[model samples]
Target: MKRAITGLLNRLRFKQKLFLSYLVVIIIPILVLGVYAYNQSKEMLRIQGIQGIVKNVDTISGSIDGSVERYNHAVQSIVLNKTFQKIVTNDYSDLVNLSYDLQEYLTPYFNMMVMLDQEIDDVKFYTQTYVPEYGDSVQSADRVKDEDWYQSALKGKGSQWFSDNGLIVVAAFPRFFSDKATNLVYMRINEASMFKNVAALAKDGTVAITNDRGDVIYSNQGATGERLEAGQLQGMKEGAIRIGGIESYLVKKTVKQTGWTIYFIVPAKELSRNAGSIINATLIVIAGCIVIVLIMIWMFSKTMIRRIYALNSVMKRVEIGDLSIRIRSESKDEIGELTNRFGSMLARLNDLIDELFRNKIVQKEAEFKALQWQMNPHFLYNTLSFINWKALRSDDADISRVVTTLSKFYRTGLNRGNNMIPVRDELEHVKSYIEIIQTMKDHSFDVEYDIDEAVFGHTTINFILQPLAENAIMHGIARKESGRGLLRISAKLSNGKVVFQVQDNGIGMPLETANTLLQNDSSGYGMKNVNERLRLKYSSDYSFTVESAVDRGTQMSIVIPAYLQS
Candidate 1:
């Protein structure tokens, strides 16, 4: 699988491959962490919710215990009162005196005590001896004594709880009227009113209070029928469980004094709903971040790939011998540096090729010069013998002067094994050639130099001028009859380049014939050799312009790079 993916990647462009790799490297981690974090966060929030609910249950349980404590203390206050004990244990013969004493002392205290607690519904005292009925509260003693609560209050010791289909809490204590018997004090508070705050706090779910006997006492939802079984409440203190038919997360806190457990119940799905939303939101933001990152990676990779594609395209052209290709490398990264290096390498390769070609041309020129030198001696021997004979027979110094000019021409033309010579030497050699031609032709052609004086010391190819001058005299001036033909040569510098021209005022041919003469063939070696030699020595950027017209003039101009060897 890995190899197949790699092969497919190799077939794609560099930018696509880089974008894929970066996405995998970056996005995979983001996705993996996003999922992992989402799940972990959801679970953490669930636990945290359970903890918060447990605290809520504890707060409610504490409030219930506080209310019960206050009720019990109020009863204890009444039991410890000496005045109430003396009144209950009093031997008042008349009920009227006792009624007056109870009303004057206890009625105002009961009204004041009821005013202190909002949940306090009634505060009553049951006594077997005195004020059992109408003296303190009811009008008949039988009505009070006949009640079960009055009888139970005498038997019961501490706080007692009884409900008349509604939740109720009673604070009962003994009033020690005498050693043999004791009266009871009862302080009752409405349990429904006491648990109202706890019920309000349970807006999301149900809150219930159950006694130690597995009987539910009070519920926030007013559900007192169903209670947690002892088996269900056995081991689990806090967890999710089914109560009756409802599945809920249950938090249980047991009040030590009352042995009543406060139960906070929320639906299992409700506990996770808020936490799930938070986790989902986090995942969405992470996905968005991943998308933005992928876009940036693709953009960066595309820019780099564009540069590489350009380099590769230019290299393809270079492969076909077009070495003029160049890349605009302005970046500073490693890839940009690589592009710059490739450009440098191509330039170096082009230079090496040009150098090799120049070396080949130089070798060929040397061979041509060697062959020409070998063919020169026969002409020299015959010419010297003829010159000597002419001088001996005619007794004329012109023949000696012609022989001397020919000798100087050949000597300077050879130039002691150097292809490059000063402009002065070339002009002198051409002057010797013109002198020979003037003698041979009865002085019919005239040659003049309008050359720059500074151009004399400058370097040029040896014998270049002499050959052009010879071509002028032979091809142009010799064709004209009875005309004093003129050949002009000039040289100068222009725009950092060296330029010189050869002109002849004679029977000049047409432009087509002038161009045909410069082409190298079996009969056209001189112009071709000069053109090739100049191109090899300098660059191929030099120019050779030919201008000619019938019976007017012909001009052969050559431009080469300026190089002064000091």
Candidate 2:
């Protein structure tokens, strides 16, 4: 059976195999487990919903109780003030004294109480004593004698909180005077400030504060005029119940300061919304897991196949004489190890090629030396000196100078068959070549030298500068349309390296031509030859760079490590 199953899988395409395996390994087991988890999570969510509602109701109860206590204390403070009590109970004999005393003392005290608490709208004293009403701060008791809140204040001994149309009214009866007067201290508090927290907690629900008589005193739903049914109030003791034809969650807590119950009612659908969201999230996560698994399977197969194809490509390149190709793989698997071995083989082949190339260079140099030795150096110098003497005798200064400069140029360039020469000697050789060219051209161009004295002690490959200077004169300076070109040769030592530059202000070549100048060996005894000689003598770090523009100029730079002659 195992062999049959393996054969069936091998015959399927890669994507088909992935989908079939995923259906068996992940989809089947997850569907079964997801059903079981949903059943368990539904029950847990309902219980936690009730607990959360209860805690929220308790918090609202605490906040309402704190507001009530604060207002009660404020009322009590005014009632106990002896000066206030005297002002309320005193009977005026002279009308002028009464007006003066009310303006100077009582008016300022009432204004201060209203200023201290931003929630306090007004502070008034109601009394049957014969005192003039002063700007709504004092009023006659006859106006509210029949009111229920006033009656409750008259009957109560301490401060009592009363709600009238969502407004908070606190009244306190003072007993500090012996006149036995029906005097009440009344304070009105802003209702919105008192119930702001309840409004915040009742987003999708209704919150109400109901008195013992089941009358809604303050409701965030604007149902302050409604009264809770006796049956609904009784059913609240037993958890959630039907309220107004909807099955709802009821959480109620009694405000300890006033004996008022705060009721929080949320419909069943609203409470179960979170559980529905959690179920939808679980389904999405399962679907996402299946998608991610499919993607991972595709990527795994593609990666293996891609590496194999890359190895094949590398082998094809090696067949076409391209041994510089490299494969950078960190994997330790069989394919990765194969790639590593291939790279090692390419490296060995490159080393062998370099060895053969160096041997060829040595053979060519030996042939050049043999050709040089065939000529007698003393005889050549003597013949050049003899021609110089004849030109001088004939009174031809230009010919004599040219011959002398030619002799000096050859002497410096030969250097007794040594391949390396001092930087000073190389500079002198190029100077002689420049002098010969200037004499030949009738001094059409200017020459400038910016050689640093520090480079005089260092040595470099011979004939590196002469070929560059010759190219500058032949290709750059000689083609200037301005008829007077400037040739600047500069050498400097920087950061343990020596840099030499040959620049000319002439009709320059295009960037494409400058780029290919040193890339091939077709230009014999030119820029290519100079670059090859430098590469063979020094490390590969040595480089040549060329810059040119049509109207601007051409500048060629050579950079090599500074080496002192031993």
Candidate 3:
């Protein structure tokens, strides 16, 4: 019964795996993208909130400035009036009369001042001393000198405003008379009523004011007398600041006469509350998505685990030497492709395994036949040496010298069965080969060497240079219409390694062909053997580079191990 169940599982295939892969690939990316979008949207909303606060604060600053200008003009008019000055210079009987007459004359101005304060709410004046019937109370002359507004007004010939303070009169004082004998004038303001319009305009009703020295003069919510630290005040003219875990916008304007700074402050949260909705919505959507995704993951995992168990059962059948088990899938996807390819590969593997089992004797017979047909080069070398001896006996020195060079070339190439030798030995072998070629071609090549002596003994693969030299001469220079060529071989130490280069002044290869020679094995002629040897010795760090341009020339470089054989 277990074997029957196992056989049924083995027949199950690609559709299930493909569906799970699709879930992972598509659904996972969607979840990731949703999270990224959520974060980005939240940040954007935050920035927008800050900007809105700044904008609102800027508008409030302009309005405050306008109010300051109007208030300053009214004060200046009262101070510069010639009639009022005359009243100040007179004695009691005359001063009293003048005060009443001046009051009647200034009725229109007083009414206009009252109307202005109706929008802004409060204005008050304090004198140093009391006068009978000036109002209900006596503002003593001694108190004038100690008052900031009184002293500041007296010192100045023109009008000025001071930073907001908490001692606001809360009622409109328009143009009040100070009956003090002293020349000082004191003033007060009701900030809430004065900045009422500004508060009404607030999206979240956040605004405040500070003095030039960064003292909190007024806040919209009646918060007062707060002081900013010196470090916070430094280099701050007007901008934004983070306070009490919230960002606030600040704008400053100088009171022309008092030299006091007026600052408008608004909290970022209040100004950007509109944009806050966007953030909340984004977070909710992301959270919803996460919950949905978690549910999906749970479902997908359960289904995938079942499918994997089924596939594992089929795999065990094959592991136990059952080759007939096959995969079946209903969906077309990565899993389907994998199952189809695996089935095809199994068929091919079975064919190859059968072929090998049946032809073992034939393969051995072919190998022996190939070995029997091969000839050793030593026999040819001995025959050539015999000819050289005969030529030397006949007084043919040129023939004898060529034979000797050829013998030396073959001996060095064998190198006591070593696959690697010093670079110097390789160069000598190349030189000997070049000598023989020069003799045959009547010295049709100018070979230049720029080898570094310090790297002469570094080991390189045997016959690394000879084949390249032969190719440059035979297929390259010899094929050109001009029967002359320039072969330049350069080797140097660079960046802790030796770089070897061979450049020929022959017809260059096309860019495409040159690229193929370096990148593809099939396009490399003698290069295939060199590449295989290099791979056997080192890793991908070792390289062969070829640079060529049609009708220009070609340069080939080899980067090998720079160490001496230890």
Best lDDT among the predictions, by candidate number? 2
lDDT of all predictions: 0.73, 0.80, 0.62
Residue-level lDDT tens digits of model 2 in 196-224:
88888766677777776566677655222
TM-score, per-candidate, Cα-based = 0.41, 0.60, 0.46
Off by over 4 Å in 3: 1-300, 303-396, 482-484, 495-498, 517-525, 532-539
| Preferred candidate (TM-score higher): 1 or 2 | 2
Sorted on TM-score, best first, the list reads: 2, 3, 1
Per-residue CA lDDT of model 1 for 1-566, tens digit only, reads: 99998798789976777777777788777878788887778778788677767767778878878877877677778777877766656657887777776788778888888887778877766555544564444233345566655565556667765543554444333433445545566555677788887877776777767776666677654232354444555565568787667677878788876678777778766676545667777878887888897889867976657777777888899888788887658889877898899999988988899899878987868766884586566578588878877886898888888887888887778876678887778778888988999999988877787877776657777766776887888988999876789989888878877788999997888778878765655254477777767776676768877788999878989887666856
Indicate the worst ten consecutive residues by lDDT in candidate 2: 222-231
Worst ten in a row by lDDT for model 1: 221-230
Mark the regions of model 1 whose C-alpha exceeds 4 Å error after superposition: 1-33, 90-93, 130-132, 135-156, 167-182, 222-238, 244-246, 272-284, 287-566
**Model 2 scores what on Cα lDDT?**
0.80
